[model samples]
Target: MQYRMLSDQRKRWVDCLRGFCMMAILLFHTEIYYTGTSIIGYNLYVSDALYLFFMLSGYLLYKKAGMIDIKYKLKSVLRNLLWPYFIFTSVMAVPKALAHGERVDNAWALVQNVVTGQASWFIAALIVAEIFFVVALRLCRGNLFALGSVCVLSFCCSALLALNGNLVTFWQFGNALQAMLFLFLGYVFHRYEHKLVVDVWPTV
Candidate 1:
């Protein structure tokens, strides 16, 4: 059997980081709604765990793309993410619309909710980010710098658009852009793991 030192180390480190993020998410959700305040600064960290989770996802998927069929991966994502999103959101929207005296069979209304992210918005943003990343990877031929530039431009666009939240549907697109940025950062971290050392310190 052959052993790879850096690969093993990176895998263990990423796993541990994910475990920590899971715990943080658990704690954040448990307390955030009821307490309405910070828990020893965990509040500050809570918002970041989601971004880190998305980043880790991108890092892993980018590596897998090089090893597997991209078309199959894209189809799997579409089936798993978008399909469920549409079904569940439509199911919820129709009843809610009835209760509110809105038209019961409004396809445009359903699509607007889906696009404006009235459903599971996070999942919608994630689906868009994943699809965008996968397509961009194929076009860029896995060029990290080119992809990174795209992510940077996305961030700039998000910032500029967010400033006019009244006009643009900034929240949805801003979140998607930020998700892409974090995903790209995760890919960068994985690709350069050999040169990076992550350190942790006890909070005293």
Candidate 2:
């Protein structure tokens, strides 16, 4: 396959999509935080939007992850998750624990909160998913396409199992699989993004 760099305009579009995704994420968090005040669709719509964001997140961060060397990419991945995790969990856990007169066990669990850090189990989920996906990628020797599809199906099945137990319904996925997907999508975009020129832009 031949490789060609993206034009200025298309890069701008990816940047715009990224910025929009960030805002959507923030809005979801904000609404979830304020959901106690009877804000309409605060929990529902915002949560749903966050799911879409997760589903598409893999499609988004692909390029940056893919273009870099694999070892470096793996390091980048760990660094991204670990540092903020350590810092935030350290910063927030003790005070909350003190307020309630009981420590939530450890800094490890606090990092798992979906609402504050990412969610109740998002960090754990992301780390698990990332590890599996990266291992698959390494074994397959860059068969990211095959490995990514498998990761998607595997995570979705886990979601199904979570549902069967009467746990959180729908929206069971997160950025782990998305990281792989977004990486592949970046490769695809870098490959065929020229096809994206269209008649008009649509708004939500």
Kindly give the number of clashing pairs for every candidate.
0, 12
Candidate 1 structure lDDT: 0.71
TM-score result, candidate 1: 0.68
Task: Give the per-residue lDDT digits (tens) of candidate 1, residues 80-171.
Answer: 98788878887788766765467867788677876666666667778777777777767778888888888888777777777876323422
The best candidate by lDDT is 1
- lDDT score, candidate 1, position 14: 76
Candidates' TM-scores? 0.68, 0.59
Candidate 2: stretches off by over 4 Å: 1-11, 32-38, 42-45, 48-57, 60-68, 94-120, 166-191, 198-204
lDDT of 2 by residue, 1-204 (tens): 123233444556556765776676677656645663435555555555444444444444444444335576568667987566656656767665665466676766555553343432455445445555556666666666676577667657655655677333222244354444444454454445457653233332
